[model samples]
Target: MSFRQGAPWPIPPTATGKVQMKNGYHQVKYTWPAAGWRYEARWHERTPWARLITYPSWRLDRTRPGKGYGPDAAPRLTETWVGDHWLPVSRLRYAAARYNHGCATSTDIELLKAAHPAAKQKKLPGK
Candidate 1:
């Protein structure tokens, strides 16, 4: 549950890096194999190779329609302080009520419970 000293952190591979199923996370290498050396590069950050840092390292095909994500779409990050690295959370094809941080957000007014107060606290309307 903690970072191992002396041992290097598990740096995820950018899109243009090679791939292979190791432990649980995908592994990446900077260079490709010379011939039939076994390892092969899969996904990279963006098209071509520019050696630039990108967020939320992508793998071969592990990504799914996890919330906020689908096949071949941009990834959604959860934790903060990862401006440079977008740590993937999960995928969400669709949501019933998603919290919005923008002014363009809206919600179902019908789901509102106590437009009025009850005895002690307002009772939510039964679905």
Candidate 2:
């Protein structure tokens, strides 16, 4: 999905932000000086059962100077909503993929399929 240039929330004075609304969530990103880059996906709407079991937001913060460095050099902090609390994530990409797939509505899947009819449907992690 293509991202728009701004976010719904107030961006910090020093940070630049962008947002993409897809599947039932708002995928937001912010880049600043020392903090590096931050990514988050917040649910826009949820079903009754989903509200009971899943957290409304998930985040990934990639520290500056650590982007090209190995995992040990930079801290790639990630958090996932698990019911009542945020759970720390060790596997960053996997956690983000899981959030994307889990938050995708049936309509979103159908739209993707329609747009890429010839492409193979790859199952997302934890799907």
Candidate 3:
């Protein structure tokens, strides 16, 4: 899709950016240079908001057993947008995973899968 300069992108409050493609249905361009993270969320108008971005991110719940940290804790699973697929990026506790690039709920994962059926499934390092 072509980019339409100055057009507003449909970015959730958690994200920040404007659309860079005019021919695209719905695209959200996000970039955090200092954080070394850049990704895009594209969805059709009929799709739900949660499924807009076909990416799986670490469930953002701080109340989890270990909050995704410490030893013997739950795995830290985040999403990576690879072309038309969203692949899971898992980091075991004590594995030094970044939380900012993660989701906060399982519902988001389900929704993302619905949007991108070809998404890659990944398990924790040893789980």
Clashes per candidate (backbone, < 3 Å) = 12, 0, 4
Q: Which candidate number has the best TM-score?
A: 2
Provide the global lDDT of candidate 1 against the true structure: 0.25
lDDT of 3 by residue, 15-52 (tens): 44454333423333443322423434432222233433
TM-score for each predicted model, relative to the true structure: 0.14, 0.31, 0.23
> Which of the two, 1 or 3, has more lDDT?
3
Report lDDT per candidate: 0.25, 0.38, 0.34
Error of 1 at 99 (Å): 40
Instruction: Using TM-score, rank the candidates from best to worst.
Output: 2, 3, 1
Cα RMSD of all models vs. native, in order, equals: 20.9, 13.7, 15.7
Worst 10 residues of 2 by lDDT: 116-125
On lDDT, the candidate that comes out on top is 2
Alpha-carbon deviation at 1 in model 2, angstroms:
28
The number of residue pairs in model 1 that clash at the backbone is 12
Any idea what lDDT model 2 has? 0.38
